[model samples]
Target: MRSVIIATENLGKFREIKTLLADEFDVFHSLRDFEEKVPVDEDSMLYIENAMKKARKVGDRFGMYAIADDSGLEVEALGGRPGVRSSRYGRSDDERIERLLSELEGVPWEKREAVFRAYLAFYLPEKQRCYVFYGELKGIIGFERKGVGGFGFDPVFYVPEWNRYLAEMTLEEKNVLSHRGRAIRAFKDFHNVRFFRNPTVHRL
Candidate 1:
């Protein structure tokens, strides 16, 4: 199978990509699996810019196809604060949750809306082309964290339509609506359709 490198230090993110692309290619991690530790600046204000930077850096370094994702939580009540700084919203995960809850304190449920936004970039060094994909998950911020299944803001992100926090859903269930999962699905489907139309061009 053709190999594809995913540039990310987060194991959970790698696992999600693996699950999404298992049938299409041999997915590997750019840093963890290969012991590569080159740093790429993530100061870009936009998720696509950050994702493209990482993907291009890793793809050029390894001379292989590379994929990277930049995702964060955007809260309407907070004026879209912590959007690109989701990981560093606070000193720690617990602190981040606390801060989120504190920020929404006394805010009406109708106004405590938020969404998870993800941007995925694929770099093909051989083809000299980059493809970008986007996905989003809409939900409201809960007063308190709930469940223990997911990382980041999962516990505090409640999908009112589903009446449950993201952390309360199983991995499979979450993937169906997750920002990362949705992006990967779109990328995979696009590749599949393109390859199907041009059978002469081999693509994993």
Candidate 2:
């Protein structure tokens, strides 16, 4: 099987990506399988830049194909704040949730609209080419946190049309509407149509 390195330390993300690409490539997490701790400075102002930097860093180091994703929640009321800093929005996850909740306090539910944005970067060292895929999920923020399934802002992100928090939905349900899932699906389709034609190269 051909191997691909997924540049991320988040276990939930790793699991999702592994499941998404299982049939097509052998996926390995940098932190778990390789014990790599090199931090890719995400100082880039844009999501694409950050994702590409991580993917390129891993691909260059291992001389293998690499994939990286940078995602975050963008609250319309907050002027897209806590975007790139989604993970570290506050001291801890709880703190982050608190901060978000506080920010939305007194705001109307309709004005509390938000969207999750994901940018996926793929790097092919041998080909010296980089590709990017993006996805967005639109939903409104709930008055209180709900569910306990997903990590990050899942509990606080509510889809009124679905009448449930993101964390409350099953993986299958989330995969169809979540930003990360949509990005992965687009990436897979791109790979299948654009890069997977040649069987000479092994996939990982």
Candidate 3:
């Protein structure tokens, strides 16, 4: 049975990716699965670069395939102030939302345009090769946080098309409309083509 590591410590992110890739691999793992956890610094300016860094490190440590994702919220009004540092905006999710709202204080709703961007990186340790997939969801910042569904910025991310907050949507609904979901789907499609066509390639 083929096994792959998700290369993340975030429970919410691990759950979402694992749910989407449940049938893709025989065994799944996260950083918490091993005692000697691989340390990866997400210091890259680009999302893909940061994701690749994590995937490569974990894949090397575990001697298997590893998938990692780097995502952030980019606010147009703030000129993407927290694009790469979304996770570090504050100590907790609530604090992050508070900081974001505070930064956008007095900003009109129309100018509160923002987009959630995700980049998933798949790495093969033996081959030292990496593949990247990208996905994005555009929305505006809400006046206040709402719902208790998703983690991170979901509570305040207002989707005009859906006329609701991202946190208001169910898991299935968010999976179909989320940035990370789209990226993982794209990765799955690529894996199907590349691995199936070249069966021996995945054995590495």
Candidate 4:
């Protein structure tokens, strides 16, 4: 049976990945599913570094293929701040949102442009090599939080084309427009082509 580990403990991200890749694998797991956890230090300055670090660490620890992703919210007004440190921006999601809003206080809508970026790294334990995929979404930072869906900065991410906050969209809708979703989908497509041609690469 083909199985792979998702190198993340975030439930929201896990669910999104699972929803997209469930049919592709025989077994799927997140970091929380493991009894003995592998501690990973995500202190990389780049998103690809962090993602590959997690995938390599977890894949090597368990002797299986692993996929990891790192995503961030970069505000133009803040000079792309909170880029790789989006998760550490605050003690919690609310605090991060508050801090972001506070920093942009009194800033007009035109200057509130922001972008969400995601990088996904896949580790092939047998080959000891990692491949990365990238995706990004452009949007503006709303003055106030809107909607009740999505996790981390989604509420304040205003999609000018859609004219709705990310949080306002359903899972299906969000998946179609999210940065992580785009990256993961590209990763899936790459896997389909690679693994399909080299069937034994992952089955081993």
**Clash totals for all models, in order?**
0, 7, 0, 0
Question: TM-score of each candidate?
Answer: 0.90, 0.90, 0.93, 0.92
Worst 10 residues of 4 by lDDT: 195-204
Q: What C-alpha lDDT do the candidate models reach, one value each?
A: 0.83, 0.82, 0.87, 0.87
Q: On a 0 to 100 scale, what is the lDDT of residue 167 in model 4? A: 94
Candidate 3 to truth, TM: 0.93
Compose the digit string of candidate 4's lDDT tens values, residues 1-62: 98989898889899888887877788999999989979999988888888888998999999
Q: lDDT score of model 1?
A: 0.83
Models sorted by lDDT, best on top: 3, 4, 1, 2
Error of 4 at 18 (Å): 1.0
| Tens-digit per-residue lDDT, 120-204, candidate 1 | 8888887766787788899999888899987888999998778899999988888888888888877876775442221121111
Clashing pairs in 4: none
For model 2, the superposed segments whose C-alpha errors exceed 4 Å read: 195-204
> Tens-digit lDDT track for model 2 on 34-99?
765667799977888888888888888888889899999999999997898888798777789899
Candidate 2 residue pairs that clash: 2-202, 2-203, 2-204, 3-203, 3-204, 4-204, 26-204
Model 1 / residue 58 / CA error / Å: 0.7
